[model samples]
Target: MENAKSKIKLGIYGIGLLMMGVIGISSSLSTIGAKFPEASQTMIQNLISIPCIVIIPTTIVVGKLMQTISKKNIALAGIIIFLIGGSAPAFMTSFTTILVMRGILGVGIGICQVVSTAIVADNFSGVEQQKVQGTLQASQMAGAAIMVFAGGWLTEVRWNYVFFVHLLAIISLILVAVMVPNTKPEKMTTTGDVQKTKLTSATWGWVIFMFILFISVQVYSISLSFLVTEKNLGTAADSGLGLAFFAIGGIIMGLLYGSLAKRTKNCAIAVGCLMLAVAYVVIAFAGSMIVCHIGSILVGMAVSAALPGIFINTGMSVDGFSAGMAISVVTCAQNFGQFCCPYIINPISASISGGRSVNFMCFIIGAVVAAALTILMLVWGVKKNRQVI
Candidate 1:
């Protein structure tokens, strides 16, 4: 029993490490921008977001592959790819080469991200499952916090050194290889019948919810530097501090998610959306670094609260056989929203302000949309609860 517990703990940690791959380059954005003066700002920003373009499709492929492949093996292979793609950019000379490598890193992230959540749904159920899911999110946020801080420090030495952060995947690779069991695909149910999997309407609802919510929240990461600099509030390095605070807020909310979910029950997403609205309002009007940091933290908390709620609902809405695919679909929606954030939000922000750059006005727009989402989530939650009753 003790041995099994240890393995479960290790598996959770491995998933956390895998999640660190998503934002590994976030802190390096400023340094990369300085290095490539010839590149357009949009192009420089793409270096951080280009991976999501790949992650979207890769997640779907990984979901299909999970039907026959051992998750442990997939995780190991993904980490190997993650290490290579994540670290290779440090040594590359060409901007195109770096962009390609970032996409390679996305493929790796796509593989493991689906597997990580599926493993939890496959092994646990009920409150225990909720607890583990919260832990999984907390661990991911904690790992991201550490990486953001470390990556920022590394950038002080050289722009390329930030890529070295990918080497940490080696530890995750070892953990998954040794500690995570090679659970076979659930081709057959316990009754010796072929298990059929299909996504329900509720599952699709959560997917859409996650996509819309992420579109608003992602502006925080993609626009932090611009918001700070445009206001003359701080330098590029200071944006890292705001990002760190964002992660710190996520870590706190993630740790509390199980309890929060229990208390909020059907209304969890509504509460999260409301929090997000308030957070954006705070950020939109900030005049000092301290206010900006508070806003960043609130944004983190809002996301942690809302996203895990979506993941947990999506996982519970499907059977064991469909868990991975359901998660992959939701993840694809989430990533697609993130990838389209600049395109969608920027145009609207530009039209409203008659400017091309994203600014505090973007956050104001986010706040208004988030407030509307809060009402939508409340109505949906009530309808869902009535159906359950």
Candidate 2:
């Protein structure tokens, strides 16, 4: 492929937009829920699931279609879907309509998530691939930081104004659609020496990792309009700033990730997961709502470091695996966690105490997850290094 442009630059701007679009979908709902006291937290969580429900099957269908379709065609399809999804607030009423639009948004995000990364990977090789991926992730965190904060503020002024975040993605899509080269897949691996891993390992690991990560996300990522109003966390805009801090933590983690990984390969991911687990517990056990915000920032940091590692590792592990599957499983797991948290809490609240009791459980579960991940990563790392059990 021609050295058409700097892959790092391409990745940052491309993913910055895609990530902005993806996070915008969730944040719009969540941030709106944050400002408005009318909706229940459980209901808000349910809305988050709307997109995930649609994305599971859509991912596979899109993956298969990627083989034949022009990247331009697929991306255009994704953007149109995004525009529809983004316009939901402008067009729809009632919670149900919001959910329907969210599902459409999910399809767009799912398609672009996989396809965009694949385009970068297709164009770049070796160290450049790693750098580009890292840059893309950092850009994503940066976008989330800005967009979520903006969403929160917009919710206060006028909720529909938040929809404009999707417009930001247009630059990324247009650039990628026109400027990025469509190179044929080479027969050889981009990074040398590492054996092409099997589909079985890749698929199984992707699913497992996705589920694990989302478990923590349940407590971390909240559409907690209930809590926001209940606790009086300044204003809706201030609330988004809190979320932005979390994303900023993630950006810091991503920027530092390459150095972290060089030490133990999966060092960043392993530690990231461990931190997430701890953060989840902290969030669950939080007495004041402020603790929840702290936990969110910590969780975002872990997610920033861990998720890209999982995607890269999965991409490397399975030669035939679709990027759509990679994006799908991770996102589905995330949304699953978001869905399950409230569902679990609803039933538990009735049985135990009210919401407070459930929060404690969230913390306890997070602790257990951290311990499990710490053990798993260390064991895996040791084995990879050929150290004895």
Instruction: Highest TM-score: give the candidate number.
Output: 1
How well is each residue in 1-389 modelled by candidate 2, as lDDT tens digits?
Answer: 34466643563356455553545534455556655568776666655566655665665666556556655567667777876786665555566777777778878866776666666555555666666666677777777787777777776677778766666666666766666555433334566543332355656676676776666555545433334444454555655666777788778877777776676675567787788777766655555557767876787788777776777766666555344445545555555554465566446544654555444554565557766877787677667656422
lDDT of 1 by residue, 1-389 (tens): 76875696687667676574666667567667889999876687787678878889999998888898988888888889988999998899899999999999989988877888878877777887777777787777777777776777788788888888788888888888888888778688779988666999988987887788878877777777777877888765577677778888888988898888888777778888898899888877889989999998888788778877788889878876898899999999888877887778877887887553456777877888889899998998888778877
User: Which residue pairs in candidate 2 have backbone atoms (N, alpha carbon, C) closer than 3 angstroms, thus clashing?
Assistant: 33-225
- How well does each candidate superpose onto the true structure, as a TM-score? 0.94, 0.82
As a TM-score, model 2 comes out at 0.82
Query: Where in model 2 is the C-alpha error above 4 Å?
Result: 1-12, 20-40, 183-198, 223-225, 281-294, 320-341, 344-364, 387-389
